[model samples]
Every structure is written in C-alpha cells, then in structure tokens.
Target: MKTILFLLRKEFLQIFRNRVIVAMIFVMPIIQLLILANAANYEVRNLKLQVIDQDHSSWSRQLVGHFTASPYFNLTGMVASAKKGITAIEADEADLVLHIPSGFERALRREGTASVHLNINAINGVKAGLASSYAQTIILDLHQEIMPVVELPAGLSSTFRYWYNPDMDYYTFMVPGILVLLVTLVGMFLSGLNIVKEKEIGTIEQINVSPIRKHQFIIGKLLPFWIIAQVELALGLTVGWLVFDIPIVGSLGVVFAFSSIYLLVVLGIGLLVSTFTDTQQQAMFISWFFLVIFILMSGLFTPIESMPGWAQQITRLNPVTYFVDVVRLVLLKGSSWWDIRSQWIALSIFAVVINGAAVLNYRKTD
Candidate 1:
C-alpha cells in the first residue's frame, strides 16, 4: 500500500513537471469543443428542394408558394419537368425534388385525387427522413387549411414540435459527449504509449529490478494520467458551463462516478495496447485507430438510429458508448442515478473486465 501511494505520487509529479503537455491536455479539448459544438447540430434547415410543377394552374402556384414560405424548405429549382427535377436530385444539386402530377389542381378540385412525388436522398438517412417528414406535414397542413369546411376525425391533431433539442443550443447536446470522447482519446493514447516509451528507452528494466511490485509500478504510472484526465474533464465542464451556458442539471457525484469507471476502461485499453506493441509509434497508431473506430460508432457525431442494423449492433460492445450516454444523460437530460443505473453497471463491469485483462497481459519482468 505504501509502495502504491509512493508510486502514485511519483507519477503525478512526473506528469505535472511537464508544463507543455499539461497545457495541451486542457486547452486542446476546449478548443475542439468550442469549434465543433456549433457545427455538429442535428437541426435540419435550408433544405434545398426542386419543384417540378406540371400543372401551371393557380392552385399549383399556391403549392409552390407554400414551399417558398416554409422555413424548412429552400426552393432552389423550378424545373420544366419531373425528369429534370429527378436529374438535379441525382446529381446532388438538390436534397428534395417534388413532382406534382399533371393536372394536379384539376384532379384535386374536380376529381379529388392527386399524387405528389417526393424524391429525397437517404445518404444522410436521419436528416433526409426529418426533411421528408417536415415537407409532407407542411403539404398536409396546406390541404387541411384549404379544405377547412371538410370535417376531420376526432382524435387527430398536429400540435407537437420535434424540438431536436428544446433549447436549440447545439453545444448543450454536443459538449458533454464530445468532451467525454476527447478525454478518452487522451487517456487511451498517452497511457498506452507510456510503458512502450519506457521500454524503448530501456528504463523499464531499471523499474523491474527495483523493490516495487508490478502492480505498484503500474498503478503509479496510471495515477498521474488519471488525475490529469480528471482535471481536463473539469476544465472541459467549466468551459461547457461558462462559454456555452450548457446546463448540468444532474448530480455531480454520478458524473464523477461514471467518469472514473469510464476512465478505467479507457486506461485498460491503453495498457492492453501497450502490451502488444514494442514501439511508441506502433502504440500511438494502434491507439488512434481504435479511438477513431470507437468514436465513429459511439453515436457522438450522429444518431445510432441513422446507422444500419449491423453497425448499430457493433456499437453495443464499445465502451465509449456508455461514457457518452452517461455524460449526455447527466448534463442534458438531467438523468438521475436511477435513470442510468444499467449504464453504470455495464460501464463498471467492462472497466473491471478490461482492466483485469490488461493487468494479466502487461509485462511485469523486464
């Protein structure tokens, strides 16, 4: 126990002694958080649309006017025909192309039947889906207003807003998740490469000959990085609150608990990677690759629902998923511990299992 404490103190001093690394550890993430928080919004807007109106009647003009007036739609093209509109959409010039059937006004007024073709690019499935739904709703609302004398079913209403985020501040939703990811990258990358660096420098042999046990030495090495990571997290949260005005409406204890558990998993991953690689470059590359894959799959930049079934299933095993969820829940949704009990359990279990494997794989003797 004494050895462990001594090692922890030693590691802490070694990390803090490097002023440049400490500055980067805090500043880089805040910079990224500030820049990306604005750009990573899920709110759909200015959706480019092409109108292929075959019926050049007053009613068709009115429909086109609906598109022009809508905040959701940006009328980018008024093409001669549906074929041209579809061509524009296929060429990626437009996100949505609406082809009103021939004699649309005649059919609606005289025959009470008309179909509007809607072409939406599903490449970005989530935004495309939302845009398509919004377009459809606007058209329906137009029809309802036009036919006001017609009676409607009793249990139907369109009185709710989606509120992708009610506050509409992108940073509120983004900072928590992205900050967690940024810490994951730092923790995993630095710690994973530390042992490999010592080995490369031939300093590991000296540690091996010392009276310190493997566990003590290992714990000591991690102690400094762990505390630094926590300080970085605190700085990130401070930035989130001070700059973006993002609310942290949940318990700080829960946030700390989950963060500590999540760090264990990240550090375990780093240690495990160190065991396999002999060089710092190899460790760095391996760590970055894993971090990229985990972040992409962890539903940080986009919704997991937007991904395919197999891809979504793959994220279930990623440790970053739980961390992102925990932070987002505590920060944005004000989720209580009970609300995140299952996530806590899962992260804790993964931390234990992964750290155990790392310790097992890590070399003790030089």
Candidate 2:
C-alpha cells in the first residue's frame, strides 16, 4: 500500500510537471465541447423550398403562403413550371419543390381531390424526410382551415408529445454524449500515451529496474488518470449545465459511479495497448483506430435500432456503447439504477476481463 502511494505521488508529479499536457487536458476539451455541441445538430432547419405554381389560383397561393410562413422552410424562388423547379433541384438551389398542376383548384372544388407533386432532393435521407414531414403538416393544417367539412380517412390524424426534451434542443441531447466522449479521450489516450512517453524518455526502464510489483505499478499509473478523468467529467457537466442550461434530472452520484467503472475499462485497454507497443506513435495510431470505431459504433449520432442487425451485434463488444446509452438514459430520462442493471453487469464483466488481460500481458522483465 505504501509503495502504491509512493508511485501514485510520482505519477501525479509527472503529470503536473508537464505544462503543455495540463493545458491540453483542460483547454482542448472545452473548445471541442463548445464547438461540437452547436455543430453536431440533427434538426433540419432553414430548408430551401421552391414552388412551381402552374395555376395562379387563390388556393395554390394560400398553400404556398403556409410554407413561406413556416419556420422550417426558406422560400427561395417561385418558378412557373415543373421543369424549372427540377432544374433548380439539380443545380443544388432547392431542397424541396412544390408542383401544382394547372386547374388544381378546379379539380379540388369539382372532384373534391387534387394531387400535388412533391419533389425532394434525397441526397441526405434524414433532411429529406424531415422537410417532407414539415411540408405535409403545413399542407394538412391549410386543408383543415380551407375545407372544414372534408374529413380525412380514419387513423391518419394523430398527435405526438415529445417527452424529456420537449423543445428538441440538439444541445441537450449532444452535451451528455460529448461529456462521455471527453472523459473517454482523456482516460484512454492519456493513460496509453503516458506509459509510451516514459519509454521514450528512458524513465520506464528505471521504474522496471526497481523492486515494484506489477499490480502496484499498474495501480499507480491508473489511479492518477482515473482521478483526473473524473475531474474532467465534473468540469464538463458544470459547463454544460451553466452554459447550455442542461439539467441533471437523475442522480449525479449514479452518473459518477457509472463513470468510475467505465474509466477502468478504458484505462485497462490503454494499459494493454501500452504493454505491447514500444513507441508513442504506434500506441497513438492503434488507440486512434479503436477509438474511431468505438465512437462510430457507439450510436453517438445515429440510432442503434436503425443499424443492421450484424452491426448492432458488434456494438455489444464496445464499452463506449454502454456508457453513451446509460448516460443519455439516466441524464435525460431520469432512469433509476435498476433500469441500467444490464449495462452495469456488462460493463463489470468487461472491466474484469479487459483489466485482467492487461495485467497478465504486462511484462516487467521484458
């Protein structure tokens, strides 16, 4: 215990002794948080809308007015024909085109129905889907206002209520996920890089020559980083709350508890990487490859349910997946500890196996 304490003291000294690393530890993440929280938005706003009105009727004009007044769309241009609207879409000038055929009002009044063609640039499927939905809602609202007695088919009209984040603010959803990522970056990269940096500076050889046990050395290295990562998490959460008005709906203690366990999994992986690699560059590239895969598969931006079945199966092996999911569930939805029992069990097993492998693989003699 005394030996571990001494080593911990040494590691902390080494970390604080480097001014550049200290700055990077705090400054870089803050910058990334501020930028990414705003930039990584999924909501489709300010969509470019074009209208081709062949019929200069009041009904057609009213429908176009509904779209223009909508906050989701920006009416860019009004063309005379469908061909011109199609040309605008091809030129990347329009995201959606509303085409009203000639005698549209006449057909609606006489036949009680008229078809309007909607052409959307499906380059990005999410954006197209959202734009289509927004446009359809406006059209429906207009139809109800203009034609009162004309009732649509049953089961077609339904209302939805957004829970937790009713405003659908992207920042609220993204901040917690980004906080998880920041903690991960600090824990995995710094811990792996620290060991490799010691190798580069010939300090590791001196430490290996000493009468320190492997467990003592590993504990010493991981403890300081573990503490640092927790501090980083706290700082990030504070910034998110104060700056972005993000609330901690669930138990903050639960959040810290989960993070503490998750840190061991990542730190152990870092140590495992350090055990095999001789140089910092090799460690960096190897860690980077895995981190990228972990982030992409972690469902940070996309829904896990939307992914292919095989791909979703692969995410079960990723520790980040569990952290990202649990953080969002607990923070946003106020999920209880019992609700995350499966994640806790999976992470615990992951920690034991990963750290145990790292310890077994570590060689003091080599």
Candidate 3:
C-alpha cells in the first residue's frame, strides 16, 4: 500500500510537470464542450423554399403565407411555373418547392378536394424527411382551419407529455452524452500514453527493475488517471449546468459512483493498449482506433434501437455504450442505483477482466 502511494505521487508529479498535458487536461475539454454542444445538433432549420402558384387564387396565396411564416422555412422566391421552381431546385437555390396547380380553389369548392404537389431535395435523407414533416404539419393545420367541422362520435384522443426534456432542447439531450465522451477520451488516451511515454524516455526500464510488484505498479498507474477523469466529469457537468442550463435530476453521488467504475473500464483499456505497444505513436494510433469504434457504436449521435440488428448486437460489447446509457439515465431520468444495477454489474466484470489482462501482459522482468 505504501509503495502504491509513492508511485501515485510520482505519477501525479509527472503529469503536472508536462505543460502540454496540463493544458490538454484542463483547457481543451471546456473548449470542446462549448463548441460541440452547440454544433452537433440534429434539428433542421431555415430551409429555403420556392413556390409555384398557377392559380393566383386567395387559397393558394394563403398556403404560401403559411409556408413563409414558419420558422423552419425561408421564402426564397415565388416562381410563375413548375419549370422555374424545378430550375431553382436544380441550382441549389431551394430545398423544397410548393406547386399549386391551376384551378386549385375551383376544385376544392366544386368537389370538396384539391391537390398540391411538393418537390423536395432528397440528397440528405434525414434533413429532407424533417423538412417534409414540418411542411406537411403546416398544410394540415391550414386545412383544419379552413374546412367546416361536423360533430362525430366520441373517439380516443392522445396527448403527449415529454418527460425530462419538456422543451425538446437538443442541448439537454446532447450535453450528458458529450460529457461521457470527454471523460472517456481523457481517461483512455492519457493512461494509454503514460507507459508508452515512460518507455520512450527510458524511465520504464528503471520501474521494471524496481522492487514494485505488478499489481502495485498497475494500480499506481491506473489510480491517478481514474481520479483525474472523475474530476473532468465533474467539471463538464458544472459547465453543462452553468452554460447550457442542463439539469441534474439525480444524485451526484450516484453519478460519481458509476463513473468511478466506468473509468476503470476505460483506463483498463488504455493500460491494455500500452502493454502491447512500444512507442507513443503506436499507442496513440491503436488507442484512437478503439476509441472511434467504441464511440461510433456507443449511440452517441444515433439511437441504438434504430440501428440494424447486427450493429445493435455489436454495441453490447462496447463499454462506452453502457456508460453513455447509464449517465443519461441517472442524470436525465433520475434513475436510481437499482435502475442501473445491470450496467453496474457489466462494467464491474469488464473492469476486472480488462485490468487483469493488462497486468498479465505487462513485463515485470524485461
């Protein structure tokens, strides 16, 4: 225990002595949090719209007014024909084109039905889908306002109440996940590079020839990063609350408790990487390869449920996936310790297995 404490002291001294690492540890995360929280948004807004109105009727003009008034759309131009609207789309000047054929009002009044055509740029499928849905909702609202209503038999009506995030602010959904990412990057990259840096500088040779046991050395290397990562998580959460107004709906203790174990999984992976690699460059490349795969498969940007079956199955193997889910659940949903029990157990097993492998792989005699 005394030996481990001495090694921990040495590790912290080394970390603080490096000015570049100090800046990376404290400054870079705040900058990234500020930038990425605002930039990585999924909401589509301010779509350019072109209109083709052949009827020149009041109803057609009203439809155009609805589209222009919406926050999601900008009125780029009003063309006289469908050909002109199509030309605007082809020129990248319009995202959607509304074509109201001639005699639209006449058809509605005479036959109680009318048709309007929508031409949308479908190059970005997700953006196009959102734009289409927003436009359709506006048209339907106009239809409901204009058409006469008749009393009918009572039926079921559904009302939605969005829990946790009532305003549907994208920041609320994104900040917690981003916090996980930052913590993971710090813990994984720094710890992974620690041994490799020592090896490069000829310091690891001295440690290998010391009286320190393998478990003592591994714990010494792992604990400093584990503690630093927790501090980073706290800093991120504070920034998230102060800057973005993100709420902490659960206990801070619960968050740190899970984080303590999760950092082990991350730091273990780092140590495991260092065990196989000889140089810092090799360690970085290998670490980044695993980080990218883990993060992309972690459901940070997309929903796990929406992924294909095989891809979803792969997420089960990702430690980041479980941490991301657990953090969001605890912070956003106010989930209890029992609520995250399964994840806790899984991470515990990972912590043991990964660190065990890293210890077994580290050469004490060489």
Which candidate number would show the highest TM-score if scored against the true structure? Answer: 2
* TM-score of predicted structure 2: 0.96
Could you tell me how far off, in angstroms, the CA of residue 102 lies in candidate 1 after the best superposition? 5.2
The per-candidate count of clashes, in order, stands at: 0, 0, 0
Which stretch of 10 consecutive residues in model 3 shows the poorest summed lDDT? 149-158
Ranking by TM-score: 2, 3, 1
List model 1 lDDT by residue over 234-353, tens digit each. 888898889988888888778987888888889889988998899999999888898889999898886888899999888888889888888888877678889998988888888888
Candidate 2 C-alpha lDDT tens digits along 110-130? 766787889999999999999
| Candidate 1 TM-score versus the reference | 0.85
Off by over 4 Å in 3: 149-159
In terms of lDDT, the poorest run of 10 residues in model 1 is 148-157
The C-alpha TM-scores of every prediction are 0.85, 0.96, 0.95
lDDT of each: 0.82, 0.90, 0.90
Which candidate leads the pack in lDDT?
3
Model 1 spans > 4 angstroms off: 1-10, 17-20, 56-59, 90-93, 110-113, 121-127, 149-164, 167-170, 302-314
